[model samples]
Target chain A: MSQHYRTLTANSSSYFVLVLALTALALFGLAAAHYMESEGHWITGMNNQIVWGLPHVFAISLILSASGALNVASMASLFGKTEYSAWSRFSGLLAISLLMGGLLVLVLDLGRPDRLIVAITHYNFKSIFAWNIFLYTGFIVLVAIYLWFLFERKMNQYVKVAGLFAFGWRFILTAGTGSIFGFIVARQFYHSAMMIPLFIVLSLSLGTSVFILVTQIVGRLSGSFMKQEISFSLLRLLGLLLALEGFLICAFYLTGLYSAARYDVVLFVLINGGIYTFLFWAGQIVIGTVVPLGLIFLAKAQLNSSIRLVSATVSKMIGSFCLLYVMVIAGQSYPQLMFPGKQIRSTFFDGVVVHYAPSWPELALGMGGVAVVGIIILVVTRVLPFLPVEEQRAQSSQ
Target chain B: MSGSSENLGSVDLKRRKFMVTMVASMAGAGFNLVELAMAKTSLEAESKLVRWGLLIDTEKCGVGCNACVSACNTEHNLEDHGRPETDAQWIRKLDLVDEQTSHVHSLPMLCQHCEHPPCVDVCPTGASFRRDDGIVLVDKHTCIGCRYCMIACPYKARSFIHENLTNQRSWSPRGKGVVESCTFCTHRVDTGRIPACVEACHAEGGGAMTFGDMVNPESEISHRLKSEPSRQIREDLKLNTGVRYQNV
Candidate 1:
């Protein structure tokens, strides 16, 4: 056995602790899911006005992350870029995990989660959300098949083709998910034609960052020496994407602020007034994007050292978290009406303005989904050859 | 022998063409018959014309009384008066204003009962549906409480009961996690009685609230529309709302 493998196997206590923590989280998530099912959507803080809540935000995040992971695989296989191939298996696993997590969050968010199968079977082809169901299912299947071919069987051109398809389809799928909000012509905040493209770009950044962070953490825990160059390149790419996303976000807000529409004013309040303001400025922009970008840039300038590696990994995780936060708030902030000549003030609750907040049980269930994904990835990595064992063997032989 | 063979071939071809044409005509007739049968069955099933509707005249609406709102609550067994911010009002008197001139107008607003309701269009579970009689109602049994209907509604008429609600009588028939909205006092309308709000308004001698079938020319609502100068909340949107405001 390799020295690294020996070290990983020897650290039984840490592995046990991690397993216990993840298991506890999973159990909590299952309990929350059960409670939500029995109690109905009333368990969540979501009211009529604030219909979409934390679960929706988290689900969108998972989708973006899943898509981004596919991008990594695409670059490696289809683009004939060998640098990303090393992390392809890990990235593929993360994509599947994120998608599963997203689907769970969405199902739980449904008024009738049991009717999810009905949603898939009886599709409203005109509805973007209906199309998303098929896209997400297809994307998951493609990723699974590609992973099976890569890890279980020999790496062939066919697997690469499948990976390419998954990668390309994910972009369209993520854009379609964004179009759920985008196609709401009634909602001025989401009415802009740019939402689909914005979502695609945002997903690419968030998904890529998550892929890097997960792999780095896993590599550290499993005593696998992931190439520093590969990690750095990913961090650099993610930073660039984050910068572009930031620019778009700024442009979106500026356009809203200047527009002479009532909905625009409402959006402005959501962004600048109270909790959402802090969430946007601090959580989304500063901590999520700018700081992470700065960290990655500084680390890259300093070269491939331990500090650079740690900074890049941590920043990526934070950036991904921030992107999810923004998606959730942005999705719910806009009311679905043109209130120009109406007498209604459009408050959070009452009349047309129903109040909505995610309940504790709903939030716990969402968190539990994250835990389940982590556990799944951990188990899959252990049982299956997620990392290239052949590459390691070749290095040893050399 | 050659002549006999050619004649036989021609006869066979002609017979085949005639059979094909006959079958095609029969199939077309068969499809039309099936369509007619399906239409008849639908008509039989949906014979009951329950065109539930509401009419609000801003002219006679007493601004401070809010009797219509109170009556709706009493009849529907809704929670008592809540704070303006957290209130669940089926009927609301909106204080409208001209943004440029600072001119204010109080218009009582509720479910418009729109002809092309955006809410019904977006419902994923078909929980929010429009009746053949132009009444929009929710199926409590099928409602997963997704609240997509709430988001899609232009009037913002839909309200979600956030907490666990009980003791809700059949008159209202709302529970926790299901979206509730102004059903034009469907239970009352189903009987001979007008909506609670309309009755309350009439009792107050304001005559602002009118309840009748818009489709029926003989209906009081149609007569009022012809006699009185009334306007919809957002007439520009062209929703063909059942509820109309007069003297705003």
Candidate 2:
């Protein structure tokens, strides 16, 4: 069946309000970043030990989600799922915007954001960070080209090849992101090959959830409805991806438990690690994985579709944050075991669990990134024919 | 007999003339023999043959000695920001107690100056680099303050400059939003002086630190390393660190 697409009229006052609100939020985030830069990171929760904190969680999640968001386009073009092609343009747009938001957060959180030009110009081939700089930029370029092919009628034939390339690049991009943690030989929490797959599956799960929520909101705004068949299929896909994410998380912990060297940290995170432990069991496993899975499968016959969708997506998003909090923050919270059999004490808080309480500025900066993504999606859908319109509506309008 | 005596006298006169010529040339060049040797040694500091290293006898390191730490601060002019957790600690004293035995040992920890330094390997900008003379240093000009090097260091040897720095010593240039660590007092080392921490340790602390060329067999560091039992903190990483420790 041929798919129809439509753009929002954008004349509504609510549209302007949303635009204004998102712009304000984005500005607030920028202001927060400026405050941190001027006042220094000491004002934030991060210390010398806990170098990466809340902003990293937001940035990494968004970046990981960006790659996952592209799965729709990849499915339609690369996997020959023609039904998914209708939503591919929207998917591509979301992917780029999400990446932009993530990259912005990562850059701003840097000690010297002004030297971004140096990061671009200078290349340390050995460094995974340097590699990611290329991977991230190349992803945007490739996705843009893919979107171009999807938008232009004459170039539609080459969309498949572009989709294939984008799919491969996203995989590599996620791996590069994962390797940023995995390559660190110093820390016990990371430095595993498992990070690559874990992050890849997480992106798939989180990105799909974002896609569903945003599409639903866009549908309400545009007065377009998705066919029940398509909605159910996406839900099933989400359930499957969530299961994969859950499985990987279990495997990651089990592997860590198996290693005597990593056992202490694993125990710390799982049992005694106060916030980290609670987040792992309650936030990540139950809310992120278990509840979402239950809502999709167990409650399918009993609950309303909108309730189920909202509940599962929201749970997944919350769970993702919790997991990242544990991964990024808790990972560093456990001190590096520099001396194997010796307990160390120093003025620098060595051999001690470093506690980090993220300040307001950190939260603002993170939320700013989220708002930027929101604004990008809202504006693009209004200006461009991104929202998928129903066949009947398409016929009636024309 | 008269001719033979005359020949002997000529030979003696020739020998005296040669000795005088040598002394006159040395004086003309304005360099005493000792000063010439010192200049050659100074030039060799830039060469890879001179691997600067430190050997710390943890046994001799006093438990409460803050001399080395204070000296490093004074040397670098690391301002007291009132936040010790976020301050730059180029070198700090570590008190280690064996988990099984509960025997306590004290020693100072700083940048290990590894042969295959992970910080240099992971640095995106090549700002965290190891000099030819086996000293690892962060180039202030190129360091974009990513702090990946800090994360990569196993010893937790690095610190990020948390706030905007002022009143920094001209020799030790520090700024905000950049990573800094123990430079092994490269400024002093360049001018034929040991690191302030080593000097202070010798003068006020336990005299535990011995600084010398690791490559030179005749150097005290090389001799101690050979004669005494010294080991790197994380020898399993095979980083070949320039810093070595004795006892527990």
Candidate 3:
């Protein structure tokens, strides 16, 4: 019976309420997307200067985290962490669900959402965006295969090969996502080779943090308990990855500031560029980087106690959100340089910072992407034998 | 009998020579006809023979000259819609001041139409493309409206049509969500006519802009380019833009 994992069984009333709430959130997101399509982009905060808006922030965050979710499974199978073997199926399932949620936001936000067929049919092979469509879809397929390898007892020996392939596939897939911005030669906030590695590490940290939060929440809901050893070990790894994320970000800025052409953007992001500066320092750094890192290591210092695990999870989630917000939205708000040294003036607001406040509908849509992930997790756990069978006891029967 | 046989042989040889020469001439005529047809098609089709470029003499450009802007608006029917904040600007005047010397100059800026355009490179659907003639344009039909091209454009030369577009110019069709920019007036160029902005600048004032074939070396723009030194905006990127500015 391959350890006899079971689908969760909840009270009908609670299940109904949960499904209904998730359905409502998903519907709201769909409605918002429809409105945006009908009303035109003028309704959104996005303009000529700031082409991407909250949608990108939401979608990219989910997408990156999806790739991150695979790491736990990869650890168990590929790296031979047998104890992690329990949560392995759940991790693969989480990755696919997160990825689909993220893709929903992206597709809905497209200017010609109607022309999605065109994006699929007609591709510029040179484009990173084109490469991403394949990367994203391929990721789903690969994860499914990995999950199958775990589910079928006879196919279990293929786990190592499948996990290894899946791990490498996700690394390249995420790098392709980062390279979407990295290839831009015009924008100061982008075009760094560091973005590729940054995305890879960011995906690991954010995805792992998300996986931890989801694991705990699902465990509480399903009345199952993850071993204390597994929980704390994952938390410690999260802390280390978060620290690595901060380090890589510093290296990115350091290299950028060295070049005069890129320095204006760096200064704007960190110091003087009004709202952008606040977001970077306060939203991303103080909340996302500093506090999460502090909470994680502080939790670690307590001899890896389970009581501190909650604080660690909360902080990492906050950090992940803040960093993503800074990278996606705030980054776009900063102006692109036309003339490096010229005092630029224009009616078009050249060389001036653009203000972007996401409308309510946009916020709803972003939440929708998050809610979509939740609903997927709920439904998947209900149907698939994703959870580890803790006991062959009477508790599981209830 | 021997004399008659010799006579018969000579007649047969003459007939064979005649047949060979006749077929050879017919084949030569068919070859010439095919050559003519190919030549005609080549002449009729658009050629990349001469790269169309612009030479803007910023020295002659006057301050507060809205002529080019107005002419472009009329040509493309760019609706102000009383929302300057959101209205699309195919071309706009830039006021540039030298940081070191405090020197100021006014010049129009739009799509540079680089030989190597970042917009075209980033577009997932090859909607944003450069014509063989060096004019960069957006194919609204194919555009999924991703707007990555807008982010990639260093000059901020692209604009997204935010409002549901109405009364779009027959010559310049635009739609909401589609990214558009100065097409260098491709329709006008096709008909052997100058762009509305260029014509306005010349007919009215600022005689600052020159549009012609830079590849010809004999064209007026090519002559002016050779006579005086001009520089491209953000020349460091080496995009090889069709648009050039003189004296910054």
Predictions in order: lDDT:
0.69, 0.89, 0.84
For candidate 1, the C-alpha RMSD (Å) to the true structure equals 15.5
lDDT of 2 by residue, A303-369 (tens): 8887788789989999999999899998898989888899999999999999899989999999999
lDDT of 3 at A227: 73
lDDT of 2 by residue, B1-248 (tens): 99999999999899899889988997876565544555445456677888999999999999889999999999999888899879889898999999999999899999999999999999999999888899999988889888899889999999998898788799898888889999999887876789999999989988999999998999989998998899998898899999999996
Model 1 achieves a DockQ score of 0.17
Clashing pairs in 2: none
Give the docking tier of candidate 1. incorrect
Off by over 4 Å in 3: A12-14, A300-307, A391-398, B1-45
True contacts kept of 2: 0.79
DockQ measured for candidate 2: 0.57
> RMSD of each candidate?
15.5, 9.8, 12.0
Number of backbone-clashing residue pairs for each candidate, in the order shown: 9, 0, 1
Models 1 onward score TM values of 0.81, 0.92, 0.90
In model 3, which residue pairs have backbone atoms overlapping below 3 Å? A288-A319
Which scores greater on TM-score, model 2 or model 3?
2
Interface RMSD of each: 3.7, 0.9, 1.1
